[model samples]
Target: MRGIADIFGKEWATPSAVETLMRQNKPKGFMCVSCSWAKPADYHTFEFCENGAKATLWELTSKRCTPEFFAAHSVTELRGWSDYDLEQQGRLTDPMRYDPATDHYVPCSWEEAFQGIGAQLRALDPKSVIFYASGRASLETSYLYALFARLYGNNNIPDSSNMCHETTGVALNKVIGVGVGTVVFDDLAKCDAFFFFGQNTGSNSPRFLHPLQEAAKRGVPIITFNPVREKGLESFINPQNVTEMLTGKATPISTQYHQVKVGGDIAVLIGLCKHVFACDDAAKRDGRRVLDVDFIEAHTKGLDEFEAKVRATSWNEIEAASGLTRAAIEGAGQVYVEADRVIGIYGMGLTQHVHGFENVATFVNLLLLKGNIGRDGTGISPVRGHSNVQGQRTVGIADKPKLVPLDRLAEQFGFEPPREKGMNTVEACHGMIDGKVKAFIGLGGNFVRAIPERAAMEQAWTRMELTVQIATKLNRSHLVNGKAAYLLPCLGRTEQDIQATGPQAVTMEDTFSCIQGSVGLRTPASDNLKSELAIVAGIAKATLPPNPKVIWDDWVGDYGLVRDAIEHTYPDMFHDFNARMFTPGGFYKGNAARERIWNTESGKAEFTTPTMLSSIGFDDAPGRYRLLTMRSNDQFNTTIYGMSDRLRGIEGRRDVLLINPDDIARAGLVDGQMVWLVGDADDGVHREVGPLKVTPFRLPDGCVGSYYPEMNPLIALDHHDIESKTPANKSVPVKIRA
Candidate 1:
C-alpha cells in the first residue's frame, strides 16, 4: 500500500486528479458558494474551493473520535500523531477525560462531564475560568457562550478575535467607531482603484477572486503591497465559471506589486499620507478642493498635529523605512490621488504583529483624511474570514469592559454583569502557566495550534481541569486533553439543522456589514451529532440557573426568535431582521458604517496617528530574516487538508520554507538543506526549532516564510500586539543555521 504522502504526491499527475482539484470547490447545488455547505454537496461538487472541498471531505470522512479509539491510545502517544492522523481519527461522538494512570482517555457520560464542569466552576474564584470562542461559532451559539460566561460571574470571553483581526477592531473603532469592512461585492467591482496592504487575498479569501477577476477585466487597477509575492495575488483561475476552467486559463492580477520588507508597512502608509498631503497642498495653492472639503471642515480632529508629522517626515526616511523608493511611493500615491473612488483591503499579514493596530489605524487615517467614509465605491475593508466572525464581536464577545452591553444585560436579565476585565488568549496562556487559570472552554478552534508557544500551549491544555471543544470534526484541540476533558461532536455547514419546532437557518455577517441567512442542505452524518445552537442549548440547560421556559430552548427551537432577540439587542441595526433576511440576495445595510454617523465619544469618523515601534517589528541585526507564518492551498487556517501546497509546486512535506533566491544565496544554504531557526522568545528565552527544508520562491530579500503550526513553536506567547494582544506570528527575527 502506498504511504499517505505518496498517495498525495501521485494525485497531481493524473488529469482527472487535476480536474478534480480544479473543481474541488465549484458551487454545487447551492445558490451561492457561501451556501455550498448547506447541502449534501456533490463530494465531487459542481464548484468549491480546494481548501473548502478538503475541509468538507475531512469533516464528512469515515473516522471517529470515539471512546474505543481513545481508550487504547495514550495522551502522550496521541500527541505524537501527525495533525492529519489525529483529525482522521474521526468525529468525536461523546465526552471523555484523560486517565494518566492508564495513559489513555476514559469515557465520561455527558451528565457526569457537566456535573464535573459545574464542580470545577464552583471551585474557581470566578476570575480563573477562561472562555475561548472561535469565529466558526454561530451567532446564536456565540450569544449563549457569552451569556453562560457572564452569568458565571466573569467576562473572560477570550475569543478568536484576540488572535486574528481584533487589532482591526481596535483601530477601526478608534476611527470609524465600528469594527468591520465597509465594502462589499459591488464596492470591489465599481472602484476605480484598490489598495492592498500586508495581505494576500488570493490565499486568505478565495471567494474574493470573483470580484477581483471582474475588477481586473474592467481595467480597475489593483495595487498590492506585501512582504511576500504570493502567487494568488499575481494570477488566479475561477473554477466556478467554466470558461476560465476549461481553457486552463488564469487572469493576471495586480496592476502593480510592491514587495515591502516585513514591519515596513507603517512606513509605507506614512509615505502614502505624505503624498496625499502633498497633493492636497498643491490643490490648495490652485484654489480647488481635491479632498472632501465640507466633510473635513465639519468632521475629523488632529489634522493639524498629523499634518505636522507628515511634513516633518523626510523622503529619505520614508523611502528607507518602507523599503520602497520615493518614486515608488509617489507612483502608488498618484493612483490614490487621481482616482475618484478607491477601496483599501487587508488581512492578518497586517494584524498579526506588534504594531498591527498602528498599521490598521494608518489606513483608517488615510480613508478619513480623504473623506472616503460615507461614500459609495470608497472605504477601507479589513477582509474577514470564517462565516460570522464579525457578528461574534458585535454581540458582546469581547473581554474588555463594554459599559452599555453590561447595563442592558443587567436591566433585562435581572443581574449585574461581571466587572472584571477578562483573560484574552495571551492572558489565558499566562494564567495557565501561572496556575491562575484552572479551566478553559474552547467553543471551536485548534486552540493548541492557534495559540503561540507550542510547548507552553500543549502543557497548559494538558493541565486544565476541563477543556471542552464544541467542534464539527476532530482537530488538534480535541486531543489537547486535560484531567477532565470533553469533545462534543456537532453538525457541519452541510448538515441539516433540526430544531424542536422545525428546520432552521443560521445567519452570518460577511466582510462588509452584510448580514445574510445560511441554511444547511445535507443530512447529518450521524444522528448523535447536534447543531451548534443545540449544543449551546444543552450546555446552557446543564449550566444556567435552570429558569422555566429557558431562553436557550427558545433560541434553539426557532432561530427566528434568536433573530428577534438580536433585533432587540441591536435595535438600531437589526430592527427588521426577520423580514429582511427573506430577500433573495439578503441585506447589506449597516447604517453606522455606511452613513459615517460614528457612535464614538465624538459623532464622526476621526483621524488616528500611526504608532511605529520598529524595535518590536523586526530583528535588531541588519541581515536577519523576517519570516511570515502562512498556509498552503489545501489548508484553511491551521487545518491541513493535504500535504501539497500545489499553488507553489510543493508536495509530500510541510517542513519546506519559502525564500527568495537572493535571500537563499545570502543565507549560504542550498535549496533542500535542513536548517535550525534561531531567535529569542519574548520572555528572555532562547529557542531553536529545526530540520525545516529551504525552498526557493518569490519573497523579498531579508525575509523567509514558513507554514504555520509547524513554525508556531518559534512564536513567543508574549510577542503580541500591545493593545489588542493578537499574537505577533508575522515579522519575527530568525537566523537560519547549518
Candidate 2:
C-alpha cells in the first residue's frame, strides 16, 4: 500500500481511477502496463499484481510538470538529477523543445513541433535516420513507426527487443518452426514439473508466483538453475491471498534450486540432455523404452548427430564448465525422466550472454529430447519482460523485415516496402559513432540509459544532428541532446486517450502470444498531451507525401481502422482482429510448434548444437569476478519506485555490489568497502564504473551482481552475441580494486 501511495500521491487521488482499477485490471479487465506474462482465459475478482499496481499508479499520478515547472529547471540542472528525480518532477504536460541559448525546454505548439521535425527528417538521407521503438507503445504505434520508416525508404527501426529478447526469437526460429513460446498460461497449472534456467521470477514476473504456488501445493517439483538463491523463488506470500497474507505464512516456490555459475547455462543444459541419453541406454539394456523414439524419428531431424555430440562431451568438462556436481546434473535429468509433462521457463539470465542464442536453443533441445513441444502441460516458455514487446514484434517492428511481412505490407497498403535490413540497437549505436546516422527518434523509452556502454552511447548521441523523444516524463535521454532535441510529451496508458473518434483502446500481445485490449479510463493529465497513435500519425502525416494508399487521419481517429489494416496484413493470424479485441480475455495466436507442425526449412524441428559459450579467446583469470546486471524489486526498467530492494535485503541505496563472501575474502576486501570496477574486456577497450560499495551476497564463487544502467558503462557496445547481436549485459569480466 505504501508503494502504491508513493507512486500515486494521496492528496489528488481520484475515485474514478479506483473505479477503473476495479473494472479492468487484466485477465478479467483490460490489460496491464507491467511485465508481459501471459494471463489465463478465466476471470478473477482481482487480477493485478503489486508491481502492476505500482505501474498503474506511476502512470496515473496526480502530479504534473507544467510549462511553468520547466521554466524553473534548466536542462543542465535536470541532468544533475537522478533517474528518480527527473521522472518524479511530474508528468510532462506539453510538447517542449530544448533551447540552446537558455539551456531550457520551452512549450511549442503540436503543429509547429511536427512541422519542424518533418522538415528536418525530409532533408536527411533515409539511411541517416534511426527510428527506435520501445515495448511500452501499442501495436498500432509500432506499426505506424515501421511503416513510416519503410515509406521513407529506410529500415532502420531498431526496438527494445534488440536489447532484451532478440536472441530468444532468433534461436527459437532456427530450432522450431516459429520464434515464440509453445504453451499458454493454462499449461503452467497442468505441468508435472517446471524447470527454470537462470530465471528469478519473483522480481521479474511476480504474477508467475500464482501458478508456481498452485503447482507447488499439488506436490509438483519446481526446479531452478540460478547463481543466487532469490527470495521470490524460495518462498512467496501472494498479497492477493487473504489467508496467507493474514497468517504471515509463505508458500514454497522452488522445490529444488541449483546454483549454476554465470555464463554456465549452456553447459548445464548440455549435461541434462546427455544424462537423458545415458538413461535411455540403461533402459535399452533392461529391454525397456525410455526415449521417445517415435517422436524423435517422426517429428524431428539431426538426432543422430546431436546424440553423437552429446556423447562426445565428457562429464568432467560438463561439471567443470557448469560449476555443478555430476550427481546434481543427473538428478535433474531423473526428475525430467519421470515427469510425463514438463515446462521449461527461462529469463534474461539465459538470454543476456555472448552465447545467448545458443543458450535458448539448448533449452529447446532439452525439451525435444522428451517430445515436450506439442503435448498437454508441456512446451518451451521464454518469459519476456516488457508488456506488448511480443506484440510490437508480431505486427511489424523487425530490423530484418522478413519477405512475408514486407510482401503483406505491400499487398495491403499498395506500396513497395524497403527490402534491405536496417540497424539493430548495437548497429545503430555504431552508426552514430561513425556519423552515418544523423537523426534519432524514440517512440517511448530511455534509450541512452537502457543501452550498454553508456559513456560511448552518450558521445555517439551528441554527434547526431537531431534527437526527438516521445515520452510521458523526463528521462536521461531527453537531457543528452543532439544538435537539435525535441521532447513530445504523450498520454500515459492509464490516462484517457480521446481521439477524433471517441475514447480509444489499444491492444497488446503477452509473452505467450495472447493479444488483449487496454482502455484507459481516467481523464487526460493534460489536454495538450496526445495519444501515441496520434503522435505517430501526426509525424507520418507531416513527413510522408499525400497518398491515397494510406489514410493517417482515419487510422489514428478510429483505431478500428488500424486493426482492419492489421487483419488484412496478417489474415491467417489476426483475422477478425477487432472482434477478438473485445473478447473477455483476448485471443491467442497459436504457435505451429504446439500442433506438432514444424515450419523450418526441413519442415521438422531441428536440434542445434552450439560449440562455444564465450568467444574463442575468452581466457579464464583467477581473482576475477563475472559481473552481471539486474534490477531491484523497487524498479521497473528505467522507472524507479523507491531505492529500497526489500526482497534482496537492501535499503536506501542502488550502488551496492553483490559479491560472494568467499571471493570477498580472497580479494582482501571487507564488507561495506568502497571499490572501483574496471572492465577486463579482451577487445582492448578501457571502461570503469565505481566507487561502488561492496556487500557480501550469497552468490556463486567468482560471480558478482550489480544494478543495471549504473553498470551499463562496463559493457562494451561491440561485445554482444554474434548471431543475434544482443549486448551481453549478464556477463562482463571485471576486476575490483579498493
Candidate 3:
C-alpha cells in the first residue's frame, strides 16, 4: 500500500512503474538500485521489495529539475531547503554550472561543462583532486573513473565502501585473506543456524526477508544482536505470499533477539567465544567433540592465543559491557555450540565505530573458533547497503595503492599509474578542510549529506577550486558549490542506456559477490541525460592528454570494451567477463576462503584477539548515552524517500530521538518533550542538534537512537575507526538536555 501510494503520489506512470517492479532483480531485467542483496537462483516474477519499488519508481518519476527550475532558485535558497525537498524537485535535465555572480546555477552545453572541468583539473595537481564515486554507478563506469584518475596522474579514488564497509575489508583481509563475504545465496538455505549482528534485515534489504522467512519456517535458529528491536527482525509477512497476504499471518524471523548495548558487539562476541570454549573443555573430557577439531587443526592458526584471551576475560566484565545477563549470553552461546554450520552476518553498525576493525575481527575470531568458514552454509557475510558498492571496490575504485593492480592497469592502458597511497573518505574531508584538496568530482551521490561533521564539510566544500557531480537528480552536494561547480546529468539504472553498438547492459556485484547484469528497460527520464559511462568517458577525454592506447570514444560507444579492459586488469576474477555476465542468475566470483585456500601470511585462516572488552570505553558515565545513527524505513542511505518510518511508527517528521523510558525519566524528560543532543566528543567543537522530540522506545538503558545524516552533525570528524577510517556513526557518547 505504501509502495503503491509512493509510486502514484510521485506521479510516475502506473503501468511503467508496475512493469519495472515486476522485472527488477530478474535475470534479463535491470537490478534494483536500493540494496546489495543477491537475487535468488530460482527467479520470481515479483522479486523486488517495497524499498526496491520505491527506488525504481523514484527514478521513473515524471518530475524534472529543468534549467528553468534552477534559474528560479538561487544556490543560497536551495541550501536552506531540506534534503527531501531538494531531491523531490526531481531529475536533473541538463548540464548546469554554478554562477557566482547570480548565486544560481545556469544551463550550459555538455562540451563547455567538460572543457571547463578539464581546464580546472589541468590547473591543479592531480594529487590535489579528489575522484569520488558512489555505489550507484555501474562497474563499467567505475572502471573508467578509476582509469581516468590514474591516467590523469594520481590514485585518489574513494567510493562508498570507505564509509560503510572499510573495516570489513581490513579485518577480513587480515583473517581470511579475502575481504568479501564468503557465502552465496544458496548458503542461506543450507545453514543450520544464522547469526545476525548489528543488521536490520527487513528494512535494509527487504528481499532478504524471503530467505529468512523460509529459514524460520524450516526451524533454523535465526539469532539477532542489535540495540534496537527492529520490526523486520521480529516478524514479517511476505506480500508476495497469497496466504500470508490474505490471512495476515506473519513469519517470525529471529529465534533469539538480543539487544546488545551500543559498541558492545565486541563484548558479546568475546562472551560467546568464552562459552564455546567452556563447552569444548567439558566435551573433550567426555570424549565428545563440540568444536571442529579436524577442520581447525587443518586450516587455522592463532587459536591458542585467541582462546587464552577469551578465557581471561571474566563473565562479570562481559555482562557489564554487553548489558546482558549471564544467562542470556550463555543461552545464545548454547545455540551456537549446538549448530553445525552457522552463517554470521553483520552490517554497518559493527563497522562504524572507533573499534570497528576490532568489531569485525572479533566476529571472524568467533566464527574461526568452530571452523565455521570455508564450508557451505557457514561463513561471514557483511550485508552492504548500496547496490554496487562492492562492485565499485572490486573494479578498483580504491584509495590504497596496493589494493589495485597498478602494473596490470598500466599495461592495459599504457599509462604509468601513480603508486602513492591516496585518501579515504575521512582523509578526503580532512584534506578539503586543510585546503590541500583543490577539486572534488563525484560520480553519483549526495556526498555532503552522507559524510560526518556536516557543518565543517559544508564550509570547506566551498573553498575548492572545482566541483563536478555526475548524477541523475538534484542533491544537497550540488548546492555546496566550489569556486567553480558543474552538475552533469546522467541516466538512471532503470532507464535505457544506448551506445553506438546498440543497447548496453552494465553489471553489478551483490553482497554475495554475484555479478548480475542490469539492462535498463524504461525510456530515460530526459532525452538530454547521458549514461554514466558516457559522462565518465567525456571527463576522461577532456582531462587526459591524447593517447593512442586509450580510446575514450570507443569505450563509451561500446561498454563491452570497458569490460574487456576490466578483464585484462583483473584476469583472475573477471575472465570471460562479457559472456559470463549474461548467464542466468549471474556468475559467482569464487571466494578463496570458501575453498579453504587461505591467502593469509601463514596460509591459514587466523584467529584475531582483541585487547579491549568493548569498542567504546564508556564507564557507564552518568548523563551519557550512546547514540547510534540509523536509517528509517523510508530512506536509503542519505536519500529520504518520505517522512514516515513505518517500521518504527514515526510519521510526518524525522526530527525525533528514540530513547528508553527509564533513560527519559532519568534525564527528567517526557516522551513528548523536546530536547537537545549535545555531543560529548571533547574535541573543542561544540556539536549539538535538537529540539528533537523524545520518543520513548524499548532500547537498552543508556542507549538512544536517531536517524543518520540528520544526526551526523553530532558525530565528530575525528571520531572513526583508526584502522579503516570509517566514521563511528554507530556509537557516539551524548547527553540529553532540555
Candidate 4:
C-alpha cells in the first residue's frame, strides 16, 4: 500500500481540501420545499453529503455579493477573472438587469425586473419560450417550474436531464417499464458481489465509493472496469469521519480494477452476460444445478435474441473488442455467476459514448440473467452527478412526449398546455442559431460553461430577446447577455430560504435515487439573496398578468401546495409523498427501490446483447492520442474550487495535459513541454473549435486527459455522443503537436 503522502501527494490532507470533497446537499437552496414531492422533514442523520456540503458552502457561507462589488468591476473586467475569482465575489446583492448604455450591470428594483420579464413573456408567443431546469431545483420549485412553463402554454421543458441521463429513460422505457435507476442505497448492504463499470467514484460520486469499500471489507468481490485509472477507486480515508480522520486509517476499495478502452463498456457488459448464460446453458446440458433457468423462463423474454448474440460472438472478437483478455472477462463473469446477491453500478463513463444507452441496457440484462432484481443487494445503480439534476427531469422535464405533460398541466390548473415538442439544452442552443427559440430562462445553472459549443452556446444566449439567470453568484453564463438581458440573483443552498409564504428548502436526489431533505445552516450572505422560487414567481407574475391565467398565487408562498400540484401531476409514485417524505429519509422514487417492480412492457427485467468494437487500431500517426477531459479534486462540474489536482500529480494549475512517457517520447515532447492539442477533424467549425495550448505530464501511453470546461474549448461541439447529445467529454480523438 502507498503511504498517505503517496495517496494525497501532500500532507495527510487539509480541512479546506476535505471541505471541497464533502459538499453536495443542503436544504437552504434558492428554492422552496414541498413535502409531498419528497422535501425532507428537516436534516436527518447523514442529511447532507460531502459534495452537498461544498455546494452549500459555495451557495451560502460568508460570501457577499453587493452593489459595491459590482461597482468595483465591470462585465469586461469580470471577463478576465478566473472561475474561483468570479465565485469568490459572493452572493448577488440585488436584482440587476444589464444596461447596454453603461456596459455594466446596475442594481435594479425587483418590481422593474419583474415588469421587464413579464412584458417580454407577454410579447412572445408562449410556445417560443424554453424553461431550463438545473438539477439543483427543489422538488417544490421543480414542480412550479414545470407548472409555470406548461401554464404559459409551452411544453418546451428542456432540462439538465436531457444533457445527461435522458438515454437511461429512453432505453429503459422500452426494456424496464420505467425510466429510472433500479437500485437503492440499502440494496448495497446485501449485495454479495458488485460490478462497477465506466465510473470514477472519486470525483463524480465520492459518497458512493463507501458502499464499494464496505462490500470489499465484507469480502465481497468488486469488479471495476473503466477506461482511465481513478484514485478514488483505491483506499479512501474519509477525512470527515471523526474516527477515520483521527485514526488516519483508510479502507481498501476496489478488489480488481480493469482498464477498458473508450467505448469498450458495451462489449465488456455483454461479455459478462454471455458468460453467465453460457454457464447456465452448460449446467443444463450436463444435468447439473447451475443456471437460474426457472427465474429466466418465468420473468424474462428475448432470451433467444440475447443468447444468439452471445453464441455468435467469437472469442477473438470479444477479446479484441473489449480490450480485455478472454480470461479477464470470464473472470468477471465467474464472479457474477458465483455471487447470489450481485449488484451492477455505472456512471457517465458508460453513458457518454456512442453506444452508451445500449451499454446501460446490457447491464440490466446481466442483472436479469441472474434474477438480481427485486432482491436484497441486487440491482443496477447509476451514480448521477448533479444534486437536483435528476429531480429536474422527474417532474415533466423533457423535449418530447408533450401530451402527458400537457394533459397533466391542463388537469392540474385548467390551462391548455402546448402540445408541440420543445428544445433540449443542446437543441435550444442550436435553435438560437436558427432563430427558432427567442427567450432563454435559466431557472438555476451556468449554461454557457455547462453546455457544449462554447461559442455557439454563448452566441445563442446573446441572440435571445431576453436571457435571464436565477443564480446566486455570477458565472460565465451571466455575461452571455441578450438584447434585454438581466441577472436576477437568487438564494443559494447554504442561504436562508424565504418566500412570500415562509422559509423554504430546495430538494435534490442522491446517487442512489433516494429522495432526502436539505436545509441550510448558515446565515444569508446578503439581504438581496432571493429564493429561486420567488424569482420564478416574480418572473411569471411579470410575464403573465390578470391575462386570464391560472392563479399562480395559489401555489406561491407555502411550498406545500406545490407538492399538492406535483402529486396531482404524477400521482402513482408521489401519492402520500408529503407524509412519507416527512417521516425521515424523504422518499425513494425508482422501481428498483420499490420492491423490484420494473415498469417495463412485459413487466419483467430485460437483457441486452451488444456488438463488440474489438481491436482498436492504435495507428501511430505522429501525435495522435485518445483525450479525455477530466475533473480535479478542487472542481465540481465546471466550478473549480481551486487550482490543485491532488490525484493526478497536478499542482497549482489546470493548463497541462497528462501524457504517458512513451507517448511523450513518440510525440517528441518532454514533461512540462508546451504543446498545442490539434484536433483531427476538419469540420470547418469556428476558430476556437480546434487546437488548444497545454502543458505536459506523464499519463498512460496513447491516452491523454485534461481538465474540463477550460479544456472543453478544445473539443469541437459537433463531436458529441450521437445518442445522448452529451459532450464527448470522456472520448475525444486528438493529436498532440508542437
Top candidate by lDDT: 3
Which structure among the candidates has the greatest TM-score?
3
Could you tell me the lDDT of residue 140 within candidate 4?
74
Residue 230 C-alpha lDDT in model 1? 79
Error of 2 at 633 (Å): 0.6
Runs of candidate 2 with Cα error greater than 4 angstroms are 9-15, 613-617
Estimate candidate 4's alpha-carbon lDDT, on a 0 to 1 scale. 0.67
Q: Model 2 — which ten-residue stretch has the worst lDDT?
A: 611-620
Model 2 root-mean-square deviation: 1.6
Q: Put the candidates in lDDT order, highest first.
A: 3, 2, 1, 4
Q: Candidate 3, after superposition: displacement of residue 278 in Å?
A: 0.9
Q: Is candidate 1 or candidate 4 better by TM-score?
A: 1
Kindly indicate the candidate among 2 and 4 with the higher lDDT.
2
On TM-score, the stronger of 3 and 4 is 3
- Model 2 clash pairs? none
Candidate 1: Cα lDDT at 255: 87
Model 4 residue runs over 4 Å out of place are: 1-50, 240-247, 402-405, 545-549, 590-598, 601-604, 612-623, 686-701
Q: Which portions of model 3 show Cα errors greater than 4 Å? A: 617-619
Tell me the spans in candidate 1 whose CA falls farther than 4 Å from its real position: 1-47, 548-550, 611-619
Could you tell me the lDDT of residue 733 within candidate 1?
Answer: 71
By lDDT, the better pick of 3 and 4 is 3
C-alpha lDDT (0 to 100) for residue 338 of candidate 1: 84
